[model samples]
Target chain A: MSIAEKLNTYTTGPDEQGHFGRFGGRFVAETLMPLILEVERAYTDARRDPAFKRELEHYAAHYVGRPSPLYFAERLSEALGGAKVYFKRDELNHTGSHKINNCLGQILLAKRMGKTRIIAETGAGQHGVAVATVCARFDLPCVVYMGETDIERQQPNVFRMRLLGAEVKPVTSGTGTLKDAMNEALRDWVANVEDTFYIIGTVAGPHPYPMMVRDFQSVIGQETRTQMLEAEGRLPDSLVACIGGGSNAMGLFYPFLDEPEVRIVGVEAAGKGVETGEHAASLNGGRPGVLHGNRTYLLQTDDGQIVDAYSISAGLDYPGIGPEHSWLKEAGRVEYVSATDAEALEGFKLCTRTEGIIPALEPAHALAHVAKLAPTLPKDHLLVMNLCGRGDKDVFAVAKRLGADIE
Target chain B: MSDAAVATHLAQTRLEKRFADLKAAGRAGLVTYLTAGDPDAATSLEILQGLPAAGADVIEIGMPFSDPMADGPAIQAASLRALNAGMTLAKTLDLVAAFRQADREAPVVLMGYYNPIYSMGVEAFLARAVEVGVDGLIVVDLPPEEDRELCAPARAAGLHWIRLATPTTDDARLPRVLAEVSGFLYYVSVMGITGTKSATREHVAEAVARLRRHTDTPIAVGFGIKTAEAVREVGAVADAAVVGSALVERVRANLDEAGKARPGLADDVLGFVRELAGGLTA
Candidate 1:
């Protein structure tokens, strides 16, 4: 059966309550329930409104520089010596990442809802930069919660966000990373629900957020479908994208979910290695548990305390993946894999040298997997990987890692 | 009745009697909350044991989770302090068990996120909680929609499964929330996290009046009842004025620079609790 045909038989969850097969729900304090419901209602209406769609499309085309190009990685593919690899150049988008796609949609929704304040959480700071850019464009006050540790490492993006008029609040709790940043953001949203719109940077969080974010980001897949047809004359044999909170991967994978012939692979950051007990491969290393308003695969201890996830790429340093990805993995619809920091670094260098694209470490993890899988596949096999972000923000960190002195 | 059912009935009765006594006294009851093992387990235990005598009618023990999104900076810091001091779910229940040994009548509710309880396994946690003499639970993340996951089993295990209702819980949704709820309903007075802003007395009165129409369960208003003045105002309308962040803030303030319990830290926290409880009758 075709992927579309098979999807038709399966339930397209989250049921009425935002659950992707008991994975996603409004697992929040009662104080935030009404606000979440309000967001859900506004988004549901906005989805049907042509004006909203038009506004989003206008911004996507003019502001975000979409639809991003689909380019054949001739050198990289030849180097791999198997599959013909293509690059979905989302890294070229405004704010240098795919994060702006969802931010633009959500910022528009926030305006429609009359929200005066925009808040977000960032790890690698791409989402923080995207949110800050949108807020500046709309003249809304933006506050970004980032971990203290991340703020120091992703300093370039931190300066970028502040330059865009965002107050970058450093979170100091619980290993001071993406999960803590998210917790702080959720806390802020609960406290300032009166005039705030929390632009969650990924396809995680409670109801409406996962569904709404997926819808907004599905633009990636939608564009890729058409662009791939224009380039390859048919669907690519496989799809690959990196998973943090799984937004970029979800954005790229949503439209192709039912395409049974098109294989989908999600790459997670393995840090040193999954077996080393320091990785962000939630699907590979973690189990199903509830955190940050959704039940998904989380890196948690036996006693249910969340374990700190490590990744050289700050974006992939989250403890949990999006609930849809969890469901997808459980149903065996999407294959999940992992790439270590060293492997991802190799992928980053390979893409830079071969394709002349300095990809962000997040998608470098995907490239690492692509590098491995492409070699094993036949030369006739087609593979498209989402180069989700650029590496300009990661230069300093990468330089430090490579023992290169850059003044 | 089954042993579990009987235990649940007793717990329900205990909670009801406290509220009834407050009603007869022409004032509200005080529900004081603090994170277990804050600063240190011994200091936290001392504070827990002292709450009732300090004028607390019931106690809500925060089971510190690594991620507490429902809380503001104060409670979040408290959880961090507890966790940093090596506090665990098992230790939290142990503290409660110690408290229960001396004072068995005060309704103690384990309040926090669900992962800890879930990690311990639902049945196992419930059995442990029951064995430890925990009277009720207020799992913030578990909603009425997810009653089957923990609420149903918690109730079946003979514990009062308290649910939180907020200003956003409209008349339409209140029924579902109140359906399986056994103990008093915790009404979050403000539309924010703990320790942010207090709801006006008029708003609390209106909310309490609305909640009264739906269920006869005692309503305890919390999530911003910080000051004695705010406590007094909330107490006038609701059956209980739940003070969490304000009391936890006391625990935070009374600590030394190194976050160790200073001399009379427990007394200092209990003294503040007394002042907040005094607002109930004032």
Candidate 2:
């Protein structure tokens, strides 16, 4: 049988009970089970309604600036002297990141459900700014829970969220990072279940969220497929994206899963190095465990205590990855790799100088791997990477790290 | 039967006897909860040993976890304090064993998240807990759907597997909650975490009445029954009133500026438990 035939025969899952090969399930509190089930029901109905699709499409084109360009990196491709490289420019979206896609979908669902309040948790604050922007557009009250440490480091995005009318609640527990912020948001949702809707930032959380966020963000791959076929008259040889809960990667990978010719690669943040025990590469340095409502690969101690994860980029400093990524890793459909902070910094600078595109540190991890692979492949090999966010919000931290004087 | 089986049977009998005694007294039971090693191990043990004498019919000893998502700031801080003082699951079991040596009549229940127990390996933790006389468990993160993970094994070991039901638990979902529930059903009075808003007396009475129709199990109301008046109100309708955060808060208030236990820390905490129990009987 042909490779495409064999791959096409593989069934897509997360069967009726929401188990993506024993990874994703509803492991939340009993109080949250009902609310989560309600969300699943609403999403199921919204997915089937044509009007909901049309309304989502309307906002995608006008509000979020959809069909983000598929730009060929001519200078970087020439410098690599091997593969031709292209970028799926999702960073050009209105909120300056790919986060606005999922936020728009969820806030629309919240409006449909008649929920009056919205709550979210953010690490780098991109998702916070996106959700806050949507809430402002819809005129809903918004509250964002951010770790105190993250609030200090990502001050520009924090200011953006407040300017867009979001109340940022600082969580000061358990290393004060992404995980603690999520815990606080869950606690808040449990308390105010009547009027509030939780807008999860990634392809994590319980049932329907992993599926819903991926479905919303899959516009990236859909556009890329059309644009690639239009530009090269054929599919790309490989695809690359960074994983922090794996939403952006999932968005770009879901559409091409059955295309056997496409090689999918997920890059993880190795803060210092994987051997240093300080990185956030769950697939590389962690084991399967239950946390934050799903079973996934987590950076935890032998005693099941969650360990603090480190990354120069606040966005990638999470201990757990999306459960679907765990399933994909086990199935061997996607190759999971890690890039250290130093390598990411190199990628950041190379992209800025060669392509004239200042990429966020999260996607710089992906670019780092692309830099490594592009030099090894043949000249005609085509590669596509998701530039998931812009770098304007990261200037201060990048400057401080590089010891550059912005003034 | 093996000696393990015999030990399990005795633990079950002790829990059954405590509930029966409460029924015989015609007054609601006072279930006092405190972190096992908050501040330090010695002060926690002193407080645990003094609970029964201070009128606590049943005690819930919190197994400190790094992440307690269902808890509010007060219990979260309590867990942090215990963890900072070098407490582990092994040390928590040791604390229970020490308390059992001093008091044999009062039933002790270990309450917390499930990861620590999972980390210890379920069978070994159950055996050790039964040996140390832990009569029941309330793993807040494990629900009825995942009962096969710990609840079934815990019940098979003859330990009472207590479950929690909230206001969100409707008629359709109540049976799943009551299906594997062994000892008593913990009815979370408020929809929030521990140490938050209080539930009204009318709501508690109504919820208990609804739960009684489903099972013969006793219902214990917890979460936000803080003051003596609130305990009295909850005790009027439920079989027991479980006070956790209020007792933990008392411990926090009595600590020195540096967070060390004051000279009369245990006495003061037990004194507050006594007042809550007094309210139950009033």
Candidate 3:
């Protein structure tokens, strides 16, 4: 099914209770439910209020540096096969990742809500940095919870967060990865509920957040739609992006969800392998459960305990995808697949050597699909891949795996 | 019913009387953990129904979360089972609402992460929980730092905000934890993941003993108290015995290859509950 038609079946607007395909419902605890409902009302009001849309547009254009370029990878296309491939270069986004697009919007919402404190959780540290950057811009106090393990792995991001004036609290609990960091962040929010605004990095959290983050990131697809049309005189046959909480993919895919002619693919991290029990392929191997305040497919045991997830990239190590993606999978509107760690590594290196573009490990999962799809597709068929972030942060890990000397 | 009603009912519910009965009988109470609506609401009701006969004195119904950090694999799986069974706060309350129709004697505590409650709007949840005859709430993720928000509303509603005391809690934190709470103190016997088993260490006994030093709140030790021997050891110190993951883990392990509930599984569930309850009293 086409991305556009799938989008139509789901929602670009709120449901009666403000859900998007059962996944994006407001399933929070009773205490936060009213606040969430209020936020939903506010978001709905804001979306319809032209001033709010204009302000968001202003921030996107000036603060987030929107209209991110759509670049054709002619060299890589030739290197892989003759089929053409293009990249929606979100790496060049203001915070150096696609995260800023959503952060900018959420921070604006926080400002509009008259909230003063901002709390966020980070895995690879990209979203933390983005939230920190916006918090700094808005002069809001930002506390970013990061897992200790992630802090050690992504030191440069920790430094960047510090540079942005956000207090990066290292979460020491439960394997200390993104999920743990998120738990700590949730703890912080509950403790500081009166004044704190949680800037969720993805389209997963209960009500409004999943919808709001998707709207912010939807700029990717909106821009992709316009750019692809301008650059290629037509839309690509397929739209692909990696799915960790599915914000980036949804961002680019939602605008095109109605375009039946345009296929949408979400790539998930398979870690070592899907069968290894050491993977982050939640949609592929997970079941539906309520976690982090939303009813979604999760990497959980039968008793509802969250399983620690694995991935070569810290960014893609989440055990749940955005609930919207879960609904999409159920609807079979978008095809969800996984690429193993080794496959992603190969895709990362191939993009670097052939196109001189070092793609983020998350996106490398989608790029890895190029190897399979490009070889199979007719030379005339085109693919637009959302290059969600840069791989400079992953160089050390990638080089270590490849036995390359960074020096 | 509003959270106010539930809170009032719980506050008026004879918890002190229940304790007196336990002491007179020379029996420690059996606390069973079941995900609200496991195997769907009907089966959950069945499980809850069988508990009293199988020997549950206090029942802790888990409100499933998308991310359950305090749980190990077993209870986590059970929560997923319940969630798949279409458990929601409304549905869980409905279960409690239904359970209230038959039994008002057993003090029912809603145990799970705080996110669902927080998301539900504390006032509304407190009101609804109170209305449904929910006696207490044990939010694993709610730290003492934020209990004021949860506890104050819950207190006003007359619902006991049961606190979890872990081994890591300092002497200084214990008083604050005990201050505004009632019903029981959930003494998490060990640290680390919920399901990963460790020998119920000597340290757990010490932790329970230390809790006894501070407040007189009935203390129930949970988190990996699976086997009867473990329950007996814990029950020796704790006022009440909490058996969770082990019992639920059995259900998860015995799930049909297709992850469905096999017919006639009630015997297996009851046997496990009975054995654990037997150990606690013995």
Q: Please name the candidate that would achieve the greatest DockQ relative to the true structure.
A: 1
lDDT by residue (A1-407, candidate 1, tens digit) is: 53433455333777888988758887888768778889999998999999999999999999999999989999999999999999889999999999999999999999999999999999999999999999999999999999999999999999999999999999997789999999999988877888999999999998989988888888888989998898878998999999989998998898888777889999999999999999999999999999998889999987688999999999999999999999888777899999999999999999999988899999999999999999999988989999999999988889999999995
Expressed as tens digits, the lDDT of each residue in A1-407 for candidate 2 is 53333344323767666678778777778888788889999999999999999999999999999989999999999988888999999999999999999999999999899999999999999999999999999999999999999999999999999999999999998779999999999999999988999999999988888889989999998899999999999999999999999999999998888787899999999999999998999999998887888778989887677888899989999999999899888877889999999999999999999989999999999999999999999988889999999999898999999999884
**Best candidate, TM-score-wise?**
2
Residue A301, model 2: lDDT of 81
Candidate 1 collision pairs = A3-A258, A3-A260, A4-A258
List, residue by residue over B1-282, the lDDT tens digit for candidate 1.
123444476534566667766766778889999999998999999999899899999899999989998888899889989988999998898998899899878888899999998888899899999999888899999888678889988888889899999887888788988998876899988777888887888899999999998887888999888888888888888888899998889888888888889999999999998888777774
Better of 1 and 3 by DockQ: 1
Docking class of 1: medium
Q: In candidate 2, what are the lDDT values of residues B89-150, reduced to their tens digit?
A: 88899999999887888888999888778777899999999999999999887777678778
For model 3, chain A alone compared with the true chain A gives a TM-score of 0.95
Cα deviation at B275, candidate 1, in Å, is: 3.3
Measured with C-alpha atoms, the lDDT of residue B160 in candidate 3 is: 74
Instruction: List the candidates' TM-scores in order.
Output: 0.94, 0.95, 0.66
lDDT minimum window of 10 residues, candidate 3 chain B: B1-10
**TM-score sort, best first:** 2, 1, 3
